[model samples]
Target: MKKTITIPLGSQHISLLEPVRFNFSCENEKITDVDYNVGFVHRGIEKACTEKFEYKQVGYVVARVCGLCAITHTMAYTLGIEHILNIKTNKKIDYLRILMLELDRIHSHLLCLAHTAENSGFEGMFMKIMGDRELVMDIQEAISGNRVQFDFVCIGGVNRDISTECEKLAFTNLALLDKKVDDLIGKFTSNWSTALKYKNIGALSYDDAFNFNALGPLARAAGAAIDVRAESSILPYKEVGYKMILGQNGDIYDRNLVRLKEIKNSILMCQNILSGLTEGEILVKFKGKPNGESFTRLEAPRGEIFYYLNANGTNMLQRVRIKTPTFSQIPGMVEIFKGSDYADAPAILASFDPCMSCTAK
Candidate 1:
């Protein structure tokens, strides 16, 4: 006779920062079925953007959608509005926008790597990554005046300009971060224990990734070769030397490697932006109300984040819609949980870097 058991990894857990629940049906340590819920932290930000806030204020409101990727959300919303308003921002504004966006990506990817390490019983690696992540955070604060919700991007242009001090600070810190991240890549790839916890675990094949329409590192790690930065022209990602990083095996290890490589790529992009800094006004005054519908897409740290806006040539918008990456990847995530050991669930979940706040919003 065979025995089967069920395990639930919570709507709240020490390993998770946000509210999400997963139930695993296991037979002799291998998972046979999986279920998940991502609605614990829904705050109705979409409704509030249309009902309560004006077009000018909705950018800031959407920035609160997820602190880690706040800059991405703000940039997406601002791009949609700029498209509707037909604002031709200068090159300097675009450069500065890409700088902040890359900085945000660096820090967000580090946090995800740290969380994955901690879940894999690598507390020391987690501490090292977190400590080094502060370098990027400091640069963010210096540039945008805040760590998480910078509110840097606006409808016409950026809210602030890069000063000489900020430029030097960014260059110096990125040099330091480059070295630390290289060390992390070494540890994640060469260390046997880390490889054991991560390699060949929670794998999603190329077929599965395509079938599920997965995005971000999850899809890239599976060799899906789909990246919004490469596909979408909404941002000047190509001007900043954007390259899509892909992996052959879709497992936790590959996911970590993809993120590490992306961090290096983001650092290079920031350096490129700073080196080619042109002179222009960071903010421009526009005198018309947004009167049409617009949509914009950008590559957030986790995946593609999209914003849709409908305006009626008034101060207030008629509708605001957000399609976050985590929400779209839930089906893929559930599929990965199947056929894996129940004990490996936490590490697998961490590798996906699921953001419940972004999903439920």
Candidate 2:
């Protein structure tokens, strides 16, 4: 006969960056059951978007949902409002938007990888990756004048245009970051601890991923053919040389590799956007209050971020709803926790890159 005990891992654990709680049922060293909770950091941003802020101001408010994914939140909200108003932006707006988006993805993925390394006891690698991540952060600051919570995207367009000097800086820094990413690929793939120790740890099968509706790198790491970039025409992703990346084993190692490849692909897309630059207005002036409901989806670094907006012929929106990737993938995450080693919980959690703030918002 075997005995089981329950252990709690969050809501304020050192391993977590935000407030999320997990209770594990364990027998000896192995986990037998799991319970997850994520509302500790909830700030009522969705309610504020409808009642406290006007439609135009909601973009800025929602941008605070997650600092790592501010641009995506603003973009998704803006696109939803634009859809309701039936406004079609020009090529230059689309190109510049894609540039910021890919840059956001680059930094977000690097941060996740660095945390994963740190969780696995590779402090040196964590520091190296964090240091290199500054390259993309600098580019974003040079373009938008902020490192985090850029407030770059607006209801009709972006806040500013890329200057010649800024574009030159982006090119130079991205080239350097490209080389750094190649080196990271080598380290994550060939290093003994990062590569071997991660093998077969916290794995999710392809069928399980599909059944649970896993999104972003989690699903892609399990070889599930699900990606908003490949499925939707909401943005000009296909025009900017975007390609879907997939992994075979669905383990921690596979998830890390998938992010590395995505970083590489995002670099390519940013370069393409800059190379095929167009000339036009970044913002379009429109005079009308929103009157209908609209839904929009954008691929954030973690996965597909969705927005729903409803307006009743006024400046104040009737309702605002957000469905984040982390919220959707909770089922898949709980599934991965079962039968995993209790000692591996932190590393496995880090590998999933759960963004509790975004989920709770």
Worst 10 residues of 2 by lDDT: 149-158
Q: Which runs in model 2 stand beyond 4 Å of their true positions?
A: none
Candidate 2 lDDT score at position 199 = 95
Tens-place lDDT digits, model 2, residues 309-331:
99999989999999999999999
RMSD for each of the candidates: 1.3, 1.0
**Candidate 1 CA-lDDT value:** 0.90
Supply the global lDDT for candidate 2.
0.93
Error of 1 at 270 (Å): 0.4
Q: Give the alpha carbon lDDT tens digit for every residue of 1-361 in model 1.
A: 5577878899878888788998888998899888788899999999999999988999999999999999999999999998999898888888888898899999999999999888878899889899999999999999989877798999889988888999999999999999998888999998876665678999999999989979999999999998998998767889988888999899999999999999999999999999989887888788899999997889999999988889999999998999999988988988998888888888888889989999999
Q: How far in Å is the alpha carbon of 223 misplaced in model 1?
A: 0.9
The lDDT per prediction is 0.90, 0.93
- Find the candidate with the highest lDDT and give its number: 2
